[model samples]
Target chain A: GIQVEQSPPDLILQEGANSTLRCNFSDSVNNLQWFHQNPWGQLINLFYIPSGTKQNGRLSATTVATERYSLLYISSSQTTDSGVYFCAVGSNYQLIWGAGTKLIIKP
Target chain B: SAVISQKPSRDICQRGTSLTIQCQVDSQVTMMFWYRQQPGQSLTLIATANQGSEATYESGFVIDKFPISRPNLTFSTLTVSNMSPEDSSIYLCSVVPGTGAYEQYFGPGTRLTVT
Candidate 1:
């Protein structure tokens, strides 16, 4: 099994501010994805970056597979971005998840 | 991407009762997975449901406690047997379509609260 670790266990920022979350893996992975679990409990797929970088709206992510690390950036954050961000990795058939970074955006 | 629909989006059940969550995928898939996310916790893999065969449970999950069934390629069900308050969490179903690649699409999820 692979180990996933997320940094900045907790983060609080103003609604208009920006922040970055990092995820580190213990072993090589064939697949990697970033997910945002909203307050309503729906896990929204943020990025499917096994390597390289990707952007969508105000959110973006970069995965350095060789370094075994990935980063998620939220620019001009909104109150709706408040929730837990998880980094999941797949090796064989199963995916291993990180504890996640809890983000709180204040108005 | 595959579209998945899960039944009983949310439920509150007695501690002794059981709840079965159904996952339906718009596209046929050979592999389906069940996951549990405790409050404020990371998602944990419950088991891997393979069509025409029994599911393979994770380390902490057992078939007797969380029975899973995959009768076909596009649907599966996971039953939380003899539920407890600790079982209160979001149960999500995910599937991987095609071969060679391993991208997964998840369903909305079922929120369960046992008291």
Candidate 2:
């Protein structure tokens, strides 16, 4: 089993502000994913970056396998981005999840 | 990548009763997993449902309490038997399609409350 830790347990930002969330794993992972759990409790996949970097619109993620860490960036955030962001890492048979960073965007 | 659905999006049940949650995936998948997320907590793996055989349970989770069935590649069911108030949580189903793709797609979870 691997240990996954997410930073900044809670964050608050203005609608147009930006923020970064980080996740650290204790072991190497074959799969790493960033998810956004919306206010309605729907888990949306933001990125599937096992390594390197990827960007989708206003969101981007970077996973450094060698360092056993990953970072997620949300640029020009909006009220729609107010939710919980989760980082999960998969090893041999199971996926380890972080405690998630709850974000609040004030309009 | 895959459209996943769960029946009975939310339910409230009495203690000592059993509830079965169904998971359906649009595409064929090789691995299906069941996870539990408590309030203000992270997700924990309950078990891995094998297509034709018994499920592989994780530590701290037992088959008798959280029985799982994987009849085929595209569907599975998880039953919480003899549940108590402590069993109240959101149950989610996830699937990893084919080989080489390690990313898992999650179904909109079933929110259960035991009274």
Candidate 3:
């Protein structure tokens, strides 16, 4: 069985602050994804970085497969960014999910 | 880059009742995945339904309780049978559009509550 764990189970920050979330997996993975679940419960796929780094606007992610961990950085955060961020990894069709980091950005 | 739609966005069901959820993809795909997200919890893989073949479910998930049907390339259905209070969760379907490459696009999801 594969294990995926996210760091900082919960976080609260003022708007415009920067934060980092981490995901660690117990095994090698060929597929890794970062998702944001909004207040309305919509799973927004942020990145599919099994390795390397990618940037999308104020959000950026880096996954080091050899280290078996991934990092998600949110810069100049906004209130709309408030939600639960999840990291899931898989070597097959099944994706093992992490408990997620619940982030709240206050204005 | 695909449009996905699910029927009956939300529903309330009585114990012992079964609900069937339909997932439709705008583009054709080889496989569709079903997942469950309980209240205040992360996503859990339920099963992977491949067209023209029986679905392969994850551990702790049985075919009898969670039946999946992949009738075609773009359409799939997941039935939660013999439901109970624990069956109350958000059920979602996802697909790897086009060449797939392990990038999944998920549907809006069906919110089910069993009382």
Best by TM-score: 2
- Model 1 lDDT per residue over B1-115, tens place: 8889999999999988989999999988867999998887899999999888889888999999999999998899999999999999999999988777677778999999999
- lDDT of model 1, residue A9: 97
Give the total clashing residue pairs for model 3: 0
Candidate 1 TM-score over all chains jointly: 0.95
Q: List the residue pairs that clash in candidate 2.
A: none
What tens digits encode model 3's per-residue C-alpha lDDT throughout A2-27?
89999999999999999999999999
What fnat does each of the candidate structures reach?
0.48, 0.70, 0.52
Models sorted by DockQ, best on top? 2, 3, 1
Q: What lDDT does the true structure give each of the candidates?
A: 0.91, 0.93, 0.92
Question: Candidate 1: misplaced stretches above 4 Å?
Answer: none
Q: Which ten residues in a row have the lowest lDDT in candidate 1 chain B?
A: B96-105
Give interface RMSD, every candidate, in order. 1.3, 1.3, 1.1
Q: Which has the higher TM-score value, candidate number 2 or candidate number 3?
A: 2
Measured against the true two-chain complex, the DockQ scores of the candidates, in the order shown, are 0.65, 0.75, 0.69
